[model samples]
Target: MNRTARLYALVEELRAAAPRPVTVAALAARFEVSTRTVQRDLQALMAARIPVRAVPGRGGGWSIDPGMTLPPIHLTAGEASALTTALAAVDAATPYADAARSAAQKIEAAMAGPAAAAARELARRIVTLPRPGDSAIRTAVERALAEGTVLLLSYRDAAGHESDRAVEPAGLLAADGRWYLIAWCRTRRAGRGFRLDRITAAAPTGERAQPHDLAELLSGSAAAGAVRPTALGPLPVAIA
Candidate 1:
């Protein structure tokens, strides 16, 4: 790999083994480079304020701070357009709906004048059908999920039984043009999928949400077939 690619790869390597140092010789062998070159690249990464640190001991070499994040790589005009198209294709009721729109805006802003315009034009040609739900409810769901907190929900079931529920926001599931909050329902004492439209009212409880195994939560559940795991982890996307 070139210096630039190697540098990015090195960050990922360290990040993957975060809190666990990788010896210099191991990194050099993995990247097929000399130990001296690896040391220099590590220096460059530190100079860039990438939160990389050296561990000084027999089994120590280098590690990246777990909280550190890298800036996104540059995108070509086509790539920019593809991102915009994807954002446009997402249903409006999806969690982080506003953030998704902002991401498309950021992608366009990063592109050159002509490329940005071209991406916009291409994005304009695409259309997504609107899903039924209040934007405020979606916003509340997004907040609870992003903050990793408990959600206070006034939900009405299909049988028209309305009840208040305290749920731990685990992830979102979008299916059949509607969105579901796949959360741990404290009231029900089990994993439940609350349809966004059925949520009459929602807010964050400010309590730390407990983590649950998403796969286990959805196992043998009816919604399982509607959500397929992607490389992006457990954030549910509609099965195409």
Candidate 2:
């Protein structure tokens, strides 16, 4: 379209054709431009100190330095828009929300010119606000899951009882616009799900979490259903 956009596209084209000759006729026909225009554009590229070398012989044309890499990879404007839009659909209170935001930033950084602009426009149409300060707890849960670290938690039940217990963070679950941490309770010695909002405090126990897959740990099994009167905080409950 515009000369500036065309220049960027040309750079990408040459990069894709690196170490291999791309005849001026092909470049010109691909862009629907005259041979003179292609020659002038190549001359401008040379003037800009780009390493575009000429190939000799009947089959030879123009080629870029084999070592040169322009964008590294190609992500079209449409693809970028779709990815950001999908990220926008994640719930705001979960660990994934923070990660999605960070991913969106990286995607934006990779896109340039009109592609970046289009992605921003698409993003504006898909609005979401991640919960404030959610990263603090979310990071802890994610780290615990990743490193298999045990966690010491100060949690409150839905009925307003509070207690301190140790758990092994399993996996994160998002449902009904709320966040929940599914974990293996050391006290109850069973798997349970705790609402993230109810976790008043959490700290690492410096111990490794027991090896357990989230699906198998939670499959067909329930926590110690009855919380011992003397041990009210042992089981957080899966369906509270």
Candidate 3:
């Protein structure tokens, strides 16, 4: 493999062995490279803000922080199809090029031979429907989700009067060509859904909200919204 490909593979190894430190010497031995080369790779990872730390002394090596999850590399055929389609749809959206290019590179780097060729071919052939205007609310929701923080939102009602609300953002959901925030509202004291377009301003509250049972919240909300009570009982569903 080339140096760049080998470096990517090394990152995978370090991330998989996270919280269990691996020394530069050990990595060099695995890749048949010099210890200096391994150290350079570690430096590259640190520059990317991957949370890699080097320990001091003979027993020390390098390690990633626990709970750091890399984006999944192993994609099934169905998943690959879905990703290509989604990427095509969002291709023209603002600042989407960076994420789309990054995803394509990761997939290409991870796969080999025929599989890589097929993925590229599929991506080339797909087309996405054009969407009008910027999706600022969707972008804000994603940022909040990634940082694990609450969002303070200024929302405008149908009549155009504005009100503020604090929500512990659980996740973002795309339904019927629009994005929605599936969140727990502190003011409402219940799980609520907010249409992204209705939001005027969203700022991080600088407070990390406590994690809740996402499945329970989604289930109860769905049950409450159901048109008719089930004859037998509430149908079981898994959320999150």
The local distance difference test score of model 1 is 0.82
Writing each residue's lDDT as its tens digit, candidate 1 over 178-220 gives 6788988888899999999899999877899999867677778
Quick one: ranking by TM-score, best first? 3, 1, 2
Of 1 and 2, the candidate ahead on lDDT is 1
lDDT of 2 by residue, 25-65 (tens): 99999899998988888887776566787798988999888
What would the TM-scores of all predictions be? 0.63, 0.57, 0.65
CA lDDT, candidate 1, residue 141:
88
Give candidate 2 misplaced runs (Cα > 4 Å).
1-74, 88-92, 129-133, 221-240
TM-score of predicted model 1? 0.63
Per-model lDDT? 0.82, 0.75, 0.70
Q: If both were scored by lDDT, which would come out higher, candidate 2 or candidate 3?
A: 2
Number of the predicted model whose TM-score against the real structure is largest: 3
lDDT of 3: 0.70
Q: Model 3, 72: alpha-carbon shift in Å?
A: 8.5
